[model samples]
Target: MDATFPRARKNQLGYKTSEVEEFLQRARRAYDGRPLPDDAPLDSERIRLTAFGMQKGGYSTAHVDAAMERLEDAFAFQERQIASRLHGDEAWLSEARTTAQVVANRLARPEGQRFDRVSRLALGYNVREVDRFADRLTRYFRDGWPIAIDDVRGVVFSAQRGGYRESQVDLVLDAVVDVMLAVR
Candidate 1:
C-alpha cells in the first residue's frame, strides 16, 4: 500500500492532485487577501484538518476527499463574492467617470488646456493608459465599464453643441495619448 501510494504521487495523471493543489493555492490567496473578522478559529480548523488529512496513514482517501470538496466549495463561494464586488466597483467608477466627463466638458475651453475624459477615467481607476485610445479601445471588449464607449459616443454626438464636429474625436484620441505619456 505504501509503495503504491508513494509511486502514485510521482504519477498523478489519473488523480486530481494538481487540480487540488491549484485549488488550495487559490484558497490561500483568497483567504490571505481579505481575511475574515473571526478567521483565527477557521485558520486553526483548516490547519488541523490539513494536518489530520496529511498524517502518515492517519487519514483515509475518503477523509481527504471530503476535506478537499469542502475546501473547494468554500473557495468557489469566496471567489464569486470577490468577483462580484470588483465588478460592482468598476461599474460605479465608470458611471462616475461619465458624469465627470460631462462636467469636464462644460469646464473645458476649446482653446485652453486640453483634457482627455476617457483616459482620466481609465487611469483614475487603475486601468493602464495607452499611447492611443484607438490602440487601447480593444480593452473594453468586455461588458464592465460603461463610460469608455459613452465618452467616445458622447464626444461624437454632442460635437455640434460643443462647437466641434464628430471628426474632432481625433483630438480626443490625441488627448488620450497626451495623458498616457504625461501621467507615466
Candidate 2:
C-alpha cells in the first residue's frame, strides 16, 4: 500500500515498524466494531495529542500527520452523532452555536488581540487574512448567510506580522465544519 515509502536496509532502523503496524491494526479493529485493548485510547483529543517516536527510517512524518488528521475528523464526526442522539437536535445545535460564538468572540477582538501572536521569527497565517475569513464565517453562522464546507476547507491565509496560531484557527475551523455537517 505504501510503495513510495522508504524502507530500511539490512541492519538499518526503520520507524518502529512493528509498533506502527500494531497501532494500525488496533485502530482498524476499533473502527470496525471490534473491542479495543484495555489500555487503548482513541478519542479525538487523544488522537490529536498523541505522537510517535521516530527512528532513522520511520514512517514519513507527513504521512502520519495526514492520517492523524483524518482520524481526528472521524472521531469528531462520531462524537457529533452521539451528541445528536443523546441530547436531541436542538441541544446539539445549541452546543454548536456556543462553539460558533466562541470563534466569533475571538474574531471580534482587535487584530492583535484576537489570538496568541506568532513570534516575529516564526511564520503563520496572516492576522488580517484570517480575520477576514473569520468575518465571513461569523456571518454564515450568526447572520444566516449561506456557506458550505468547501468554503471553510478552501480558506487560505497570507503570511504576515504575528499571524494567528495555525492550530487555534484550524481547531475552530474543524469545529465549524463539524457543525455544518451535523446540520446537513
Candidate 3:
C-alpha cells in the first residue's frame, strides 16, 4: 500500500506494512465513532497491546512505535472526556485515584517482593532491575516525581532464573499505565 512510515534500512526487518495500515485504518474508524466488525472495540488499552508482524523493508519500527504511542494517548484523552461527561468529574477523578492507590500499594512492597517470583528453574525479569524500576515508580506516585509515559511503557529488564514473574510485573505495569492515562 501507500507509505505510512519510512522503511527500515535496506535489509532490516520492521513492522509489516499491511498490518500497520490496517490497524491505523481501524483506529481512525474507532476514533470517528464508526462501527467496527469485531465485537471487541478498539480503545487505548488495545492500542497499547497492539503488535504487528515484522518483515524486511517494512515500515520503520521506531516511527510506527512513536505513532502508536501518540494514537494511544489521543484515544485515552477522548475516553477520559467521555467518562467525565457520563459521570461527574469527581467520579472520574475518584476512579483514577483508586487505581493509583492500588498500583501504589503494590509498588510499596519491599523491593524484590513487589511481584511474585517464578519457579527456580524458570526465567523471569531480573529482581534487582525490577526493584530499581519499582523504586522509580514509587517516587513518581508518592513524591509527584515527573515521569514520561514512554519511560514506563518502554522499560525493559534482564531475565534471570527465579526472578519476578513476568506476567505479574506486566499486569502491574499495565495498571500503572491506566492510572497515568486516566490522570493525564
Clashes of each: 0, 1, 0
Local accuracy of candidate 3 as per-residue lDDT tens digits, 61-133: 9999999999999999999999988997889889989989999999999887899999999999999999999
| Span of 10 residues, lowest total lDDT, candidate 3 | 33-42
CA lDDT of each candidate? 0.37, 0.70, 0.92
Candidates sorted by TM-score, descending order?
3, 2, 1
Q: Estimate each model's TM-score.
A: 0.23, 0.61, 0.95
In model 2, what lDDT does residue 177 have? 71
User: What TM-score does candidate 3 get on C-alpha atoms?
Assistant: 0.95
Give the number of the best model, judged by TM-score: 3
Top candidate, metric lDDT: 3
What's the lDDT for candidate 1? Answer: 0.37
Ranking of models by lDDT: 3, 2, 1
Kindly list the per-residue Cα lDDT of model 2 for residues 19-84, writing each as its tens digit: 666666666676666855574866656665666766766666666656766776777678777887
| TM-score for predicted model 1 compared with the true structure | 0.23
Residue 137's lDDT in candidate 1: 38
